[model samples]
Target: MKDLLNRRRLWVGGKGGVGKTSIAAALAVLAARRGKRVLVASTDPAHSLGDVFASELDDTPRRLLPGLDAMEIDPEREVEAHLSRVTAQMRRYAAPAMMDELERQMRLSRQSPGTQEAALLERLSRLMVDDDLPYDLVLFDTAPTGHTLRLLSLPEAMAAWTDGLLAHSRKSERLGKVLAHLTPGSRRDLASPFEEEGGDANHDPRTRDIAETLLARRRLFHQARRRIQDPEHNGFLFVLTPERLPILETARAVSSLEDAAIPVAATLVNRVLPEEADGAFLASRRAQEQSYLSRIDETFAHLPRPRVPWLPTDIQGVDALERLASCLEQAGL
Candidate 1:
């Protein structure tokens, strides 16, 4: 497997109970220790980056260690901001009487499925495109497998949607011009009926603005898609335990990601039991783990499988993450 730490963008995803966030944090700390500036952001609604870093975090990046920073995206807050921006843009193009109805529809749309994911993607795009940050690496601690997959797949869908919108906008503009030229006194009022009074009916600036915005968004999504699919720049790390369900899910996720042209750089088989355990229960569990471990080795034979030992206690805070990082280093990850 390629060195995931060498990538500019890394997305860590796995099953819910798997130690995805812990591994992501560990990687960030490890990179920072090697004198690299790193920004780790959590896209999971149920955040644990703050817990792992043992520090408060918000939407904006906050410095945790010398060269490490962390941030937790609030989906609710992002959704609200997304709605506000959309509504504001709509108001500029919509007629006064339609404002109430548009606002109502916008509010309703907020409750619809995928709104949060869309908002999160918008924020993720901003982070990826923003060049002002001095960080050498940006690691995304994503939600569970399914949600993260959907989020990664969104750019293609969004690009198609934007293309349709642009096509419609251009068609409408051309039709408006034709009607203005055909009608006796309509040349001066070529503006759309949706436009506010005194707005140019024939060449409405609002329409151009909307088209420009869609074009900009399309370009942004295109850039994000290219960045993710570029193996030399970005990597996807799927974390799974030595168990049935997580293994299956990880396999499916890897297949789906490859189908989407996004590279799955490596897999982390976390929480393997030690061979020196003495108790019968531990022995039995270890036996089962070994069986699963063999299966994992056979299944992901082509990918790098870095096994992490199960710690004596729950992993939290910087110390535990450092220990995990050390283990990862020892495993040659």
Candidate 2:
């Protein structure tokens, strides 16, 4: 588990409400305590990073300790910002008559099903490729298993989509060249809505501009995927409780991540009943948990499994987080 600390990025994900946030926070605190500069950012729309750190945090990182910072991404805001960027770019080249129609379509897109995810992917890609990122490690406290899998897969999906656009762009360029060769200087009649008033119809600049834009975005997604899967620079840590559902969910999540080529480095088996707790009910609970624990070990036989004993109190602020971090250290995470 300690090997994960050497990587530049870590993604902590699991079924929701399984102490996922606490586990992520603990790991971040643990790394920070070791003098590594760390940024713990939440990708969950319903964020608990503020509660875990006992500090208010938004999209921008806020200092939580000497070597640690925390942030919670606002998905809605990212979506709005993303659409605005695309709209601005279109307005720069689109015909004036198309502006109203474009704005109307943009408004409709705000309600589109995948717009939020696409926007979040764009934001995440920027974070991944930013050369000015200051942290030694950036830990993503991700949404639950299902959402995380989709998010990780986006770099590939968007890249493919960009490739398709580029293919079309190339095809259009070929068609234009063929038309120009056949008609000579008579190509002005072929001008469409894309041409500016004074633009040369012999050579439409829109296709070239669109191709350049798509290529730049393609590079962004490519770099993001490259960083995400590079074993030496990244690792994905999964946190799960010793329960049937979380165990099964984790297995599926790990499988999806493996299919996507993201490095699944380790697993943290959180909230194992402590030996000191004594009662008939507690014993029965521990007995059930023992079976699950055995199942987890067997199912995820290849992963480095660390067991964190359940804590008696809530983990908030630096002191409580330190206790959890110590538990992580003792558990060999």
Candidate 3:
């Protein structure tokens, strides 16, 4: 359980409306208060960290506690930014005649199903590899289980896609090279993106922009996947309550992560009933929860299961978070 305090990265996720945000916030508060520089970020499109912290938050990291910062990763903004970058990159190679079609294609890509997730994955990869990042620990408040599973599976899929493109490009280049011996201007030299832009566009007619872009992206996804699978540095923490649906969903999610070789650190069972509660109605709910708690123990017997007592009021602001943090610390996590 103490391993939670030292991980370089922790991704908190589970079924929606499970109070995962609050749990993530509490962990951040605990870590930051103990002198660890922490960044608690929300990757879900519906922003609620601001509400939990009782402070306004945006894309930028805003200082919360002395050692803690918070931000919301906006998928919409990332998608638009990704589109703009690609548009600009394509503009460098596109001829005047193709500009209208290029614009139409880019516009249509905005409404595509996987565009949002792809854009978000790029942002996440950048964050994961950022050399200038200052936080000792980063906690990601992720979306619901299904969306998160898809997001986690993307790096491999994208890398494979890039590999196919590279293979096709190589085949085309070989053919082009063979034709170049028989005809003038039949092939171009591949230019590295790091090289300074200068001279005529025809300087190296073989400038393989497709090859360079695809290769670079493949490396990025590969690096992202490596870090994501490292158990020593990363933890995939699932937050759930003592209930039937969350338990079943978590079981499936854990199995999926195991299949993907992602680390499942532990489960934080929030809103466990307290012993001091009175009344038959409350007792009945507690009895049912007891059975579910037993089920949770049996299900996740291999991992640490920390139970957090239910609060009379909703957890909010630094004060409420501090209280929750204390409970979390006492839970030995």
Candidate 4:
């Protein structure tokens, strides 16, 4: 278990409303208790880390407990930020009318399906790879199965996009230098955000270098794509309630993860009724749970299946979160 713990990037996912956030939070707290620096991030667009921690989290990472830090990545914010940086360079190159249309197009691009989520994952990979923010373990509270599957496969789309963008940038650099003479501002070439502003917006050395570097970052995305595809470094933890629909959805998600070559580390069955019973009401509930429990065992016979009992209340406060973590220990996950 220690060996598995040391070499895994655990990603908790499943159907929506199946307690993936709860399981991810518990696991994050458990790793922290074991004396590892852990970061629990929310990639779900709905953003529940704040609700789970009983505190607000912005784009910046915040310390949640003694050893655990948490953050909720708002996909829209990431996409807007990325577009703003890139468009500043684009404006320096294109004509006034063309720049206006491009800006409009970029805004529409944000509204495009999957763009925000993909950008969020790319940003998460960057944080994980940064030496300065090194962590012993990183837990991702992923979106529901459909969205999460798309996010996991985002690397392929991003790689393709990078290839096309790089080609466009090369052409833009040449055209931008030529167009600088046609503009009212007598500039040598369009400068990048990194370049100092001269009378000619095109003449900024920082802008030119930024354009070159942005194109080069294609290599970084490629490296991230390769890393995400590796099983040893990435683990998918499927969370579900012991119910029919959730169970079926989990099966579909597991199949998709396998298709994408992402590893399934374990299965977490949450809000399970305890096996013990006293009266008719309690006994019938346990019996129903037992039926589904049997199905889960049969379904995931090859993998470790950990069960977490239903708490009397929502696992919101730190004490409740810790109690949930204790259940993980009891199940020997």
Judge candidate 4 against the unseen true structure and give its global Cα lDDT, from 0 to 1. Answer: 0.77
Kindly list the per-residue Cα lDDT of model 1 for residues 214-288, writing each as its tens digit.
Answer: 888888888888888999988899999999999999999998998988998999999988666679898889888
Off by over 4 Å in 3: 171-207
Weakest ten-residue segment in model 2 by summed lDDT: 193-202
- For candidate 4, the clash count comes to 7
CA RMSD per model (angstroms): 3.5, 3.6, 4.5, 5.9
* Model 1 local distance difference test score: 0.87
Residue pairs clashing, model 3: 188-205, 188-206, 189-206
Error of 4 at 322 (Å): 1.0
Q: Kindly list the per-residue Cα lDDT of model 2 for residues 41-127, writing each as its tens digit.
A: 999999998898888899999988899999999999998888888899888888999999999999999989878888888788888
For residues 1-333, what per-residue lDDT tens digits would candidate 3 score against the true structure? 987869889999999999999999999999998999999999998879999999999999999999999999999899889889889988887899999999999999999999999889988888887757999999999999999999999888888888787677666645554554556653334332222345332233344666676778778878888888999999999999999999999999999998889999999999998899989999999999999999999999988899999988899899999999999999998
lDDT of 2 at 245: 94
> lDDT tens string, model 4, 1-333?
333355447788888888889888888888889998988888888999789879889777799898889998888888988888778877765788797789889989988977787678768778646656668888888888898777767667767776686567556755665566567876543533322334343344644565465555555666665666677777778989999998899988888877877678888899887655378998888888889999999988877887888877888967888998888888786
